[model samples]
Target: MATPDAPPTPATHPSADDVPIDKSTPDAEPPPELPENARARRYVILSFWLVVVLLGLPLWWKTTSIYRAPLPLRDMQSWADGRACRAEFPLLVEVEAPELSDPEHLIKSAQHALDDANDFSAHHLRLRLASPKLTDSTGNNAEENVAATLKLLPGPARSSHSYQLSNVSREIELFYSPSYNPSSSASSASLSLFVANTLQEIFAEEQQMISHLLSTSTPAPSSASGDSTSGSSKVNHAEIARKMSRILRYSPTYHLTFSLFTGSGTPTSWEIEDAIDEYLQPLLGALSGISNFTIDSQIQFYASPSDNVVPEWQPDGEPAEGEPQRGKWVLKKQDLSSFINSAEWPLASITSYPTINFIIYVPADELTPLSISGSATNAFLLPQWGGVKILNLPVEKIDGERKTHLTREDLKSSLDTFAGQLMSLLGAPAHPSSLPIRLDSLTRQRSAELLTSASSTLGSLYRLTLALPSISIPTSVSTAVSSTLESLQNACQELKQGRVGGEGGALAEGRNAAAQAERAFFEKSMVGQVYFPEEHKVAVYLPLMGPVGVPLVMSAVKELANFIKGWKASRVAKA
Candidate 1:
């Protein structure tokens, strides 16, 4: 649209207006250069910018925010409702009769006797008929080693008596009577009742244990297992709660550190190897399903405890050298949290594996009557950590009674205590007094607790994503959650259906559920994003945008005004 003869400046163009020459004309909105409605226009533009900065900016910020994954808040809360699973322990009772050709009848008779005598539904006995033709090799040597074994000899001089197994220490007894023969069809009262009653008496301790566990979680027999608890006995839920609180969350491999702390170097070594072989190894072997135990023992001497100079042993930081050393580094309740003496102690496990430490602190004779100042409580539990026991040993032993340094022999009693305590911390149920029975209770309890913990954790993960609005959600987390939920359902079903692990064949389903739940809760992708503050975001975005944006916006406004003016003039002409 160019013409060859046209001049570039329109102002220079001349028309037939030679007579009309105006010399005093002003342009560009007068000298001050103010446009029409300049103040109102400026205010309008300013108001628009203000709206964009305030309303629009914040809207964009919020709209493009991160996507947080959904969580199952209600499900999580329900899991924590403390009604998830009530641990029920039923003891496995084995009754054997070597003389009887048909042991099945005796087993049935004994079971009947036990059922009649039992009042607690949760802690009843399941009798196993000893195979009349037992393959001697199949008998658990571990069991045989810890209990008394009886030899059944057929005779008219009939009397049943239990005898210690010279080799295996199995709890087996011999019964005799020439005229007594029970038929396979018989399911009635006879000498079997006597035997059953005797068996019950032997396992009285086990019954009390089941009662204890039941009382902790749910409805109880009021009195069962002859535990010295009365029929009107109320559940010590708090005590049970304490037990649950103290127990270590379930782990497949439980590291048991047996540490021997002494103030002096006198008892540096112990016959622990032999004692473990004889007394402890078999019990641990029996608990294969409940847990895999790794034991490491250390004998520490001259191990000085931190002290406070004050006679009351109140804490006051480091004691000044000559000022009565006020409290002599006395430990307080708060101090237990960091009191592991990690620097000096051989704190790490030998295998470099994940472990739960069980500490035994034997203070020096110089620091007698040691306890946490003010807390007044001697033994205390550290959450998710390990347990501690402080033993006060006599300075010397006069006769067979202990009076001196802790010999390998004296350690037997202490190790026994520690071992027992370890089982408890491991959440082993107290019941049926039978070692087998106890082991079985521990297995079930662990499965139940693990199941709950994992499910609860999964539920937590479900809720967390919902609470934090600006978090990135990945498919891995979803997959993990799904897998864990599936596994938990399987485990809970197994528990309800009574298909969970039994003695050698521990509940595989429940274990899987627990493992899956833990995996889900600890999923790596869930915690990948770190939170950035809002101010930091503003700082990052404002630098480049503020300067560059101003000119671009002004240019847009001018172009828009010119287009509007031309369009309005065209419309007016048409009107």
Candidate 2:
């Protein structure tokens, strides 16, 4: 009864009115007081920056920087500018005249005349008389060293003095009249004047070639392109450029391939061995001083032109009448480049030297003598490759048809053409006409070219290093560069001294330097260094750094903002 009565009272207690609402606003509490060591927060920010600048920056630089060898940049530039050395070719002319009474005096007079006649001092010619004993001992070797051997033969019946150069040897047979007798005078010999003029004429071409080479190699303007009237020696720049474009670069050895490509299966063999030994060996021997030659011949039967052969514009008998010419097939100028299918061609040898292809194409039936596009040439030369000769059956055929086999005598003309082509491709000068003299010119020219090329390569390498600072360089590259520079210096010094003597002189030094420089410039390790950009590096490092870098940056920025706020508050308090 009592509990029921209490529950009834509790329910009626709050029903009459609600509790009163509070109307007064409470005062805003002040921000919590700043920490005592709050100002020291700047130290943490400074420490982060210090670590990034001093340690992190250095670590990144050490990891990314490239290795560049210390090169003699000044020396390389001087060499490229042709200031390190002035090239000079000093030719030694040892006169061997057993017929003369006083050979020394005559040679001296001739030398003086030659000096007066020549205005080019860089190409200096010195004359010396060979002793009787030396001449006998230096039989074949004497011709190798000397420019020419003058064999003075007195022809009493001859009205005037005449000289003839031996094609096989460097011998000049001077048939003089009775008037040009050097034995008659000791001081002034009339024969000396004749000999001097003759010698000048013989050496004029060589002098021109040397002058051209020197001018081209150095910074000096080429005499070939200058006024011919201004200089005593003149060279044709256009002709030289054309000839050089056709000639192959200098090599220590050459692989000469003599290939007989015939459409007919009948002519399966040839006497190529005897033909080469008889016609080409002597020339190769003459050129042995400058370069070595390894020759091989092959006979390929059932051979035909490539499928890409472009027919002649108009057949011989067509004359624009649209009538087909019978039994006439030829290669046009445009077809010359594709004539030799290099993909199917056999290698001459497994050697470092370049292979020169010399082909003699024999047709199955009597085809008209093949001619080049622009001219009616029986033989054509392919620039930097080789030469080609079309062999047509002789008018008087064997048994009413073409011969089955070719003998040495039958292939004489074609072989001669190949020899001439080989000489031309070897950069032998046409002037002076003498094979020996031309070979000498080739040697000097090749030496000059090598020196210039080596110096240029050194300069290029130095510039490349400076341009690409991020490219990694290996120790092998550095070693090769050092070797190249040393060899180049040696070559320059030898050139300055004019040491163009019997081998091991400026010429040989230049060749060595060129080889070394080429090797250094074309180093595989040096070329393999790929460049990576800053963006690429950042992308690679982003994942590793994102988690750490964002928090550090945000903390630093928040600390900076708090410091600014505290500084402003402190200033307000002071005011």
In terms of lDDT, the best-performing candidate is 2
**Clash number for each model:** 37, 0
For every candidate, C-alpha RMSD to the true structure in Å? 13.3, 6.1
Q: Please give, for residues 515-550, the per-residue lDDT of candidate 2 as tens digits.
A: 887887787767765455547768888997798689
lDDT of 2: 0.71
Runs off by more than 4 Å, candidate 1: 1-24, 28-234, 271-275, 306-407, 496-499, 502-508, 528-554
lDDT of 2 at 470: 70
lDDT of 1 by residue, 348-443 (tens): 765644576666677665554466655433444565566666665654545754344455575565556655666777776554344654564565
- Clash pairs, candidate 2, are none
Question: Which regions of candidate 2 deviate over 4 angstroms?
Answer: 1-55, 97-105, 133-145, 151-153, 181-193, 217-233, 271-282, 294-302, 306-352, 366-377, 394-404, 407-412, 431-434, 492-503, 529-551, 571-575
